[model samples]
Target: MRKRLFILGLLLIGIFLFIWINNKWIVVSEYTINSSDMPAAFDGVRIVHLSDLQRTSFGKKQLPVLEKVAAAEPDAIFITGDLVDADRFKLEPVLTLLNGLSEISDVYFVTGNQEISKDRAEEVLSALKRTEITILENEKAKWNREGETVYIAGIHDPLMDISTYDPLIDVNFRNQEIEYSKRARDYTRESLEEVPFTDDFTFLLTHRPEMIEEYAETPADLVFAGHAHGGQIRIPGIGGLFAPGQGFFPELTEGVHEFGDIRLVITRGLGNSSFPLRINNRPEVTVVTLEHEEVTGLNK
Candidate 1:
């Protein structure tokens, strides 16, 4: 009887391991963000946010990830950054996915910390340009439909070049033990100065979710970010366990986080950077639908 029990335990362990491995594979998460600020014409617009790819590939030529994006039938796809891992720095998977996505729809790309951290930054940038992906490097792009415009802007990660940051870190934020919030906010404001807040729906694509406060300070109606990688591991009732910028028990690891009038959508991200294992945290591709409401409250 004891021998049989031991075999049964091993089988259970094997099954558990298989399920864990499967969860690391790509999973599409859908979200709808309703805002009073959204334009009537832009309502129901679908956006697929992909982040922290970090040299991870799904199936042949990233077909699993691509197939999911294609299935969404997005109006636009926003890639928040970290397309390649800083250490590994693989090109084929990155280029393959980018080329595939560009053909499907309008693809907007942004820089994550890894993009600059990697030695092959210029090479990656050049490939993106060649693919005809709109690379928003501290610049804004306009998408107009039916004479209505949606403004999209992206900022280079502050860590890419620290010399550019404002010397004065907001002590108030630091005192609260919030790392990089002040500096990130300052960097975001300076980077986005030219793109003014207008009546149109404004979207900011940032790689770091830690700068949510700074992003909210701006006139952007919506912000999409990825970098935390779902805190690598999540603890059921406690949410994500840890993240780079937000640190232990990160408050803004994944899902929707609000900052007054503005909303931030953080993707769990597909791929591992530094951490090899994930527990209860699956690779994700988030789809957010723009909802225009006549009377808006903080309900959704």
Candidate 2:
């Protein structure tokens, strides 16, 4: 009996250690995006994609995250929102991270559902405006290199449409949830309509990855997004068990998914929101390298 109890205690300790490591350890996911539409001058440009911070601090002043991003030597950094959690609203951590990131490379941002769910979005935006970071809200920005240009566009999260934002709307009745998603999609379409997309390589930054269809309708060649925290937990072969917008067995939890001519890159994100624990899904910072594929007559 004594030996059995000792073994059980050891097993429990192992379980605890595993959970702690998964939550605290940060992983860097790398991907190479190749496209003939890419400008030759922009070839080999690196982009560090971060999302759904939810006010998580990795080391003092976000050193862990900053160090990882700096190591990537990114030409630009894109954040897809949830920088502050409405439940535990704090702007200092988010600012600290932004300051460090700014020193490394140009930073770009977009709103997430969490930003809209809380009334403090204005505060967040105000703080960001004080920095060099470009806040893209239903707008477009131009990225140039060697006189060649590409467009970067961003849209506000659909939750902004709600006069009284309720984070729990997803957990409500099935019909209501469906209606909310439909409305959100329409809002996304409307927002994109405001941004003009040229034939040049274009990148779209948004919070939710589940809105792939809305984004696909646009002329964006690439989309960087988050909001599904790797579905909170991952099963080896089964993938994410659940996600906020996608629900059980959510499809767009992480990785690059293609929709016709466009590709969507979903970062697992760095922090937790409603769910406090992450199982098997380690927090990650995504590094995407752009490669301008040379088109040949045979391929064409």
Query: Whose TM-score is greatest here?
Result: 2
Structure candidate 2, residue pairs in collision: none
Please give, for residues 157-211, the per-residue lDDT of candidate 1 as tens digits. Answer: 7655543333255556555434455565566667767455566778999898887
Candidate 2 displacement at residue 12 in angstroms: 4.5
lDDT, candidate 2, 1-300, per-residue tens: 999999999999999999878887899999999999898999999999999889577878889899899999999999998888888888889888888899999999999988876576778789878887999999999998999999999999988886374546556677777777888888889999988888878999999899898899898999999999998899999999889889999999999998999999999999998888889999999999999999999998
The TM-score that candidate 1 achieves is 0.86
- The per-model lDDT (C-alpha) reads 0.82, 0.90
Show pairs that collide, candidate 1: none
Model 2 vs. true fold: TM: 0.94
Q: What lDDT does model 2 reach?
A: 0.90
Off by over 4 Å in 2: 1-9, 167-172
Per-residue lDDT value at 24 in model 1: 53
